[model samples]
Target chain A: MRRLLRVSSFRAVLVYLGLFLASTGIVLLFLHGQINRALTSNNDKAVWRDAAMMNQSYALGGLSEVEKLVAQQSQLSGVGVYLLADGLGRYIAGNVPAFPAPADTQMQEEGWLHLRLQAPFAEARARLVRFDDNLVLLIGRDLSAQQATMADLARSFFIALLLLAVFGVIGGGLMGRQALARVENINQSLRAIISGDFSARIAPSSSQDELADLEAQINQMLARIESLMLAMREVTDNLAHDLRSPLTRLRARLEKLSLSAQKTGQADDIEQGLADIDQLLSLFTAVLNLSRMEAGTGDMQQQKIAVKPLADEVMELYQAVFEEAGWTLDYVVDKAATTAHIIGDRHLLAQALINLLENALVHGVGSPPHLTLSLTRRDQQIIIAVTDTGSGVDDHQLAHIRQRFVRLDESRSRPGNGLGLSLVDAICRRHGGQLHLSNHRPSGLRCEICLMVRE
Target chain B: MRLLLVEDDPMAADLLIDRLRCDGDIVAYAENGEAGLAQATQDAFDVLIVDRLMPKLDGLTMVRQLREQGADTPVLFLTALDSVDDRVAGFAAGGDDYLVKPFAYEELRARLEALMRRKQLAQDTMLTLADLTMDVIARRVTRGAQEITLQAREFSLLEYLLRHKGQVVTRSMLLENVWHYNFDTQTNVIDVHISRLRNKLDKEFSAPLLHTLRGRGFVLQSADKLGDL
Candidate 1:
């Protein structure tokens, strides 16, 4: 709940609503004060007007003025009857309860007014008029009904203000909730993005607000980063594959140069030295091949070929070599995937397999040497198993062996560039699968080509 | 042996041409792939060394064009770039071999010699060093008239070394030619086989034919002539 209010805009909305209610209360109070003043002024004006007319009637009458005034007041209820009191505070004719006389003396303060909360009799007043000695006039009126009406008006105003307050609160809460929901979505996306989901993207909002623009900018940044990462990987891999070929050639010539140099003949020594230079030249030759692969601008004729046919062709070609070496070579193919087609460049695949075969023959010679090639479908995946009962590689160290130019100590005794397994691994990854290495029975490494079965 | 060199880099071409001529192969230079292809097509050259990427026509295209025109000449690319795809592409385009540039003249001469030998199409087609003789076509080996039986890998390794006779064959070279390893991997396969080859070629012979240059490579030559080098 507190998290919702953490938003600056939400707090601003709360402050705005609070001030709105406070201002409404202030305005209502001002209006109430104005109504009170108007009511009091109207009552005072009515009393003054009635008194003036009453005085005129009394002044016009010769002897029955008191009786006439008494007859006028008889039609109005709550309008108290009154007549002039003698100068000694004696009421000649009035409805006011006569208070006990103060000491038989006339009231020194003549124009005195009195008000009280009585239902029928509310206000009274007396004033002295100097006429041929000393005369006095007294009047009274009830104001209870007027007070009750004013109280009723105040109650109704409060009820109306209460209704306004309720509506303001509900409307304000809904508006705040909607605004908060929009902000929360953006925050959630940012949090997810920071957690390392480069694939994550903010939902494009239709609202043409500053937040929407921000989301667009963030998405663009993520795209650039992803592409750059891909580009960097391409560069590194191409360097590993392309750079080492010439180095392989150069190293070959160098070894030969050192060989000829051992000859006692000076000509042979010079020729041998020149051979070292030959290796260097060869090293400089095929460097651009990696760049070409990375660019992917080469021939676009990738095709699917049966693994058994290709494997059979390579095996037959090398069959004599293996036979001459006095080693047993066995081959098999499952009926289901008899001629399972693997999609790729034929020569590249041949080369990839050639590496695996060479690794086996050279590394497989010491321990009950036997080379077996088989193809099968397992778990909806096309698996080509190449097992050899020979000097098996350690599974723990197999991962490093796949790295370019990283031949293991045991395998290095045999002739090879370390790129064999690297190429194999690259081909597998490109094909949307990977090479699985495992131990075979007795003493041998089994290379399982874990490839995607053609859908 | 006259060789046609097609390279765009004037300085590299001149230096290589001069060095190759010094090493005894007749040198002919072409500034661009087009000129080189023209020379290679018209002339009777023993070996054609090309730069893969060149103006007027790329090395691969030029080679492919030559092959299309019925020229079965050997081609070798000289470039700064080295990638399996590049080499494969060049080979697919009908190139016989590829060499990355910034190279030693010695390595250049060896490839050219190999190309020349291949061009000559030697009748015997044998791997031989001094009294040691191994016929690759017959898959037979005879050390001074005594037949020596060798494994397939051993025979292939010996063939590769014999192909570039009078040179130190590095582990990498044997790997590529014999084991077909294009990536430079530190593998004991080369060393183990070389050790075995030394045993086969020298253990019973009066003069050991295989000499291991410590920290360098193995050299197959007349044991009588092998000096401290």
Candidate 2:
């Protein structure tokens, strides 16, 4: 509900409804005031006209004539009240039993008297006239009918307002939910694309609206991106094929030369040439693999892989090498990590772990070089960390190592082509995971491959 | 050994043919996939060495066509397309082995030998080279009267070496066959493992059965018989 309220479209609807209801309330109140004034004016005018005729009747025939006119007028109009009283305030002839008490009479503007009377006629507006013959005549109209009409108008106005509010809220809620659902659909498609499904696109909507137009535009953009990515992949593959062929021929020739030179004096130099060719080949292979992985064009055989066994296998492959190098290598699997499973390509994940282990073997040179390969589960992620007790990278250089061919070794004497960490990073991203490099407390560099655990 | 070489580059083909001819093999060469397929279909070669991208028909399609015509010749793909997907595609097209280009000649020779030997050794329950014997059914290895206990990985490594006894077995062969890993590690991890296996198999023996061939690879053969080659 809160999310629905946050939607701009739904909020607009609420704002419009609020303004509409406020204006409706103002208009209804104004109408109510005008209706009341018109009815009261009509009542006051009827009383004034009746009083004028009673005054004329009294002038022509004194008290008897006035008394006759009052009785006749009271019987003719159902809502009329007429009264003739003696000089001592005693009622002589009238529709009401007696004149109203002083407390029940309120003097209105312009000689109008508002009376709260008893039974049948609940209220009245009257005018009092005094004669020279010691008589008083009162003429007024019953205001019960006008009060009832006013009450009815107020009730109808409130009911109409309530209906408008109920329908507006319901309609607005539905509109907000619809807009939210469409937006969610677009978000889902975008997320799929982000996760390496370049073909994902938002479903076309039926209704013609701004959101529908946006969806069409997004789908068009996705198509364009997908085609461009396909073109890029084709170019990369062709380049790899074209470039590696010449390199292969060169290496083959070198190998041949090395074989013939074995009987000659410069066999060592030829062998070194062959080794250099092999190094170049390896560098080529690594760069190609990294670029493919980074572009999300690498083949991924995704399956549910048990974390412990994968880690153990990589550790086993390196355990002997570490022993041979006179380095202490430790493998630790947390209880949770043992059972944790991740959806990824086993070959690539194994390659990533091997890269980290190799990184440690080459650069991790402590007094007695120690390397730890540990797997632990944290929240929804399975972390495989390779920590080496060596001189950690300088704080500034740590971030640079993962970039392609960025070597921290200033002398450039290292055997690596500086693509191992970059390859590991690309592999991690291809698996929808991340590679985090941080310096271990005190000393050493720690590289962690954090992958999402399969449910 | 009889082999068919189907590759586009004449220079690379010539170098391969020269070295292979020197190694005492009968070689047949084709410059394109069309000519290669025609030659492969018309002849009975021990193994076929094919490059993936070629004129007329690509290696994958040629191999597919060859298989469709019921030829079961062992095939080893030698190509510059080294991605995992390309490897898988090669195998899917009826290739028995996949080797990336810019490869060591010894690696190619060893792989071809392994491919040619595959059919003959498929159902062997026991593998033996001289006095060293492995009972594949019982999972046992013995040198003469002495029994050798091998770890699981070491045992598989030994099995692979024994399967291709007297032939050069590269480090990558061991890693791929024994550990089933396709990617290469930066360090000499495989060498260490091989050394460990060597220690167990020949440390106390009078004759060293496992011999490292330096730049070439490792070969499991009796040292006394090595000079006969």
Candidate 3:
């Protein structure tokens, strides 16, 4: 119910219903006023005609003729009521029994009055006129019909407002629910796709509506993505097959040569040859893994992962490596941050951290490689940073460091194939995170991986 | 060790067989998976090296068949596909170990030796190399009545070395079998750990049991010992 109210269309329905009721009320009021005016104007015209007739009778024959005329006219079956009285305001023969209080005496001005008639006490609207000799007359009409008409109109307005509210809300709720369901369906399919199910696709309907058109477009896009993923997998497989075959044969031949060379008492060349081959193999493996990660088709499993333990394990693995490389390595895990967990492949996370630490150790060698690895919580994310006290990259070159094979040194004398940071960046992105490289103050590099704490 | 090498590439197979023979192991070569499966079932072999992609029958199918037939010979999958998913698939198909193509001969030899040694050493509760002794269940190491203090990870590292005492254990083998890491790090992290282990194992003793064989790997044996197995 709360979710339904949150739908924008439902809110629009409420606003529209309110507007409809207000306009209907205003229109009904205008019509009621116009009808009442027309009825009252007709009554006033009839009263004036009867008053003129009474004046003519009084002129022709004195109060006797006026009295006789009032008596005859009052007996007629019509809306008008007539009254005739003397100078002392005594009621004479007429339909009305007595004059109403504060009756007008002026000949030109007509006084309006409300009066009750015979049994059942029907209400009437009357006007008064006085003659030159203090003879007064009253003529009026019944108002029950007009009043009934206005009551009926008001009742109809209320019924119409009730119906509008009922239908508007019901219709709006149905439409909002339908739209929400369609959007949720699309969202579910998209989520499945993101979780490594490439075959998942939005189910489209047969209707030619806008929603169906959108689904169709989405399905087409997914098809393209699946094909592209397949092509990438094929390329990686083919590259592995074509290149590693010859490399394998070469290594085998090198082993044979090394054995024969050992017999001949000259084996240093074989050692150098084997070292170069190992470097090539490592480079090959790193590049292949980097590409696989970038392609978003890696065998990564997303599970609830605690960040502190992962950080500690990688740091432990690299601590002695740093010491052997003549660098002092230190690590601290914020206890408060240990509770933060993420959904990602555990091995990938550990590997990315190891790469960053190794990068610092390798490049930070020009100075004494004093490194600090820290894990902390930052705004719905866990930040794992490796800071090295060594020369950082140039400001302009920082942007290019995460690109493939983009070593900054012109000499290219470094042991890496320049894909370490790139791989870390790819792994971070795969986990819905990011890799940030910044210069630590007092001359050093700070590499951090920020992973979201989804829970 | 009698080893079966199932590879489609003739030249690579010939070179590998020659190298294995030179190392004093009798190696039987099969040109494809069909021939390899038949040969494997007909004879008793210590280890089977099967290539992933082969003509007539693939490595996974042949191994799966071998496993179904109750052939418990240890199988190592040799493939150019080194992705984590590929490795998972290789292990899923009843492979005991996975070695990517273009591997160094020393790595291959070390892995084969480790596989053979694992079969013979699975029942042991204690491991002793020279005067150094490791009580596996008690998690204690002592050398000539002197108890050696080591961290938890260092203890496991020493245990692995003592189990494969006479064999040459390569860095990749340690990383895979002991650390359970399928990928390699840029730095030689194994070297550092081995050095620390060396310090604790040999710094106070006259005969150093842990020896670094330069480009080869570490070997745990008494210094007075002279011959390879």
Candidate 4:
């Protein structure tokens, strides 16, 4: 739950919902105040008009005329209340049965008084006017109905605001959840790609909304990255190939001189020169091949080949070399995956496997000389691993070994361009796979290439 | 062999031409594809070695034109572009062989010799190097009366060496022609396989048919030719 709230989408939704809640609350409060003010003003205006009329009636025909008008208006409900009282604080003939005690002697002193006309009557806003000969008139509208209606409106507004708040939070949370799911899908693919599966991509969602647009934009970015990676790789490969030409001509001239110098016995120095040139050339070629595979632009004929036979073929090719080097060659295939197949370029995969085996033969020939090649079927993957029972590489150096031109301290004297594992890593990536190097238990190094299998 | 060399680098061309001449072959030099096409058309050459990038006409277009004109002289592209796509493009333009530049002179000579010999050899089932004979149809090998048993890869390696019997077959050549690998490994894995194959072919024989030349490559020569060299 905390994780969901921490997601950026969820937090944005929360912020929007909070703003909505506050705005709606303010609007509801303002609306309630406006309605209350209008109702009170209308009540006050009716009271003022009744007061003027009562005073005019008193002027026209004295107390009897005022009393008659009050008596006539008092019979109607929700109209003005009329309380005609003598100076002794006793009620006369009017709708109010008794004079309110607070309005007894101070009738003329206060201009307006809010008082209950009777014990059961609603509150009223009345004007206290002194008539001739100390007679008092209390006239105002009953506020019960207006007050009830205002209360009802206030209740409905609060209910509506509450409901809106509840639904808004739910809708926003649901939206955030949906958006987070799609984003997480994209994140999963990007993570896979970061972990060396360059073929990975964001999975598209169902709706053609903004999230879909985002997915499209992100997928476009990945496509561009993939292409740029290829172009960079091509540049390096072209550079290597270009370098080879002049170097080749130089070596040719050197060989010619060396052949002529054979009479003076200076050919040995030239042979060393030629050897250095060959080393440079082999390194150049290795880099070119590695880049070509990484670019994924070579003529790779992908086909569905049974996994075991492919492993068998590579093992057959390397077994003789291992035996010649006095290393025991062992092979194993998981019985369950005997019929497993993978879609890949056969020769490239074979080369990758051979490179691993050759790496063992070159660097892993320690005290107990043993190299094991195994093929196992994993979930939607085929793992080809070569383990050498020797002094394994340090845990720190194991990761660096897969990078280009990264040779360990001990293997510096070995006859490698230091691109063996690098090329295998590139080939595995091209096949939509990964290469994992780990120090095996009891002094050995395990190099595993996990390749996606053909369904 | 009479060879036509089309190259833009003057020094490279001179060195290559001089080396080819020292190996007892007649050579003609063309600084560009235009001159190369003219020379190829004017004279009957055994092989045409053309550089890929040149002025006036590129190697591919020139080769395509030569092929269109019904000239069957084998053409080899000596280029700096070693990408698989580049090689495919070279062959698509009717090139018989493609060798990247900065090559061992021996390798270049061997490829040309192979190209020329490819035209001379008849389409026969049997391939013979003195007493050793291979039946291409049966995938069998026999030396005199003794039958030789071999693995599939070993058989292919032996077949390639026997096809270019007396030529200096470089390791890269064997890797490309036999194993179909375009890259080189620092380890001498190919040499190991070649040594094993040599053992099977010459272990019990009187005169070794397969011979390795230091600073060059392996050559399978008949007993009579061995003394001549």
By DockQ thresholds, what CAPRI class is model 2? medium
In order of lDDT, best first, we have: 2, 3, 4, 1
TM-score for all models, in order of appearance: 0.44, 0.82, 0.82, 0.70
TM-score of chain B of 4: 0.95
For every candidate, the chain B TM-score is 0.82, 0.97, 0.97, 0.95
What lDDT, from 0 to 1, does candidate 3 have? 0.84
Error of 1 at A444 (Å): 14
Query: Residue by residue across A204-237, what tens digits does model 3's lDDT show?
Result: 8666788888988999999999999989989888
DockQ of each: 0.06, 0.71, 0.79, 0.34
Question: Evaluated with lDDT, which candidate comes out highest?
Answer: 2
Tens-digit lDDT string for candidate 1 (B1-229): 8889887767556656655775567888898889988898889887788887677898888888899999887888776555556777888998887766555444565566667666444455866677888777789999888988887767777777666655565555565677674554323445666777777877888887776765456667776666632
| Backbone clashes (count) for model 1 | 52
Local accuracy of candidate 2 as per-residue lDDT tens digits, A1-455? 89899888899999999999999999999999999999998888777788788878888998899888888876786899878888887888988889889999999998889999988788998888888657987778888899999999999999999999999999999998899899989999997776677889999989999999999999999999889889988888888788878877887787778778878878899788878878877888888788878877767787899989998888877899988998998888888888999987899999999989888888877768999999999999999999999999999988999999898887989768899999999988888889999999779999999999998
Model 1 stretches astray by more than 4 angstroms = A1-426, A435-449, A453-455, B14-26, B38-44, B64-73, B81-85, B102-105, B125-130, B135-138, B167-173, B211-219, B224-229
Give me candidate 3's TM-score against the actual structure: 0.82
Q: Which digits, one per residue and each the tens of the lDDT, describe model 1 over residues A110-224?
A: 3434444233455433333322234454554455666677788778878877887677667666766766787777677765444333456778888888878887987898677
Interface RMSD of 3: 1.2
Clashes of 3: 0
> How much DockQ does model 4 earn?
0.34
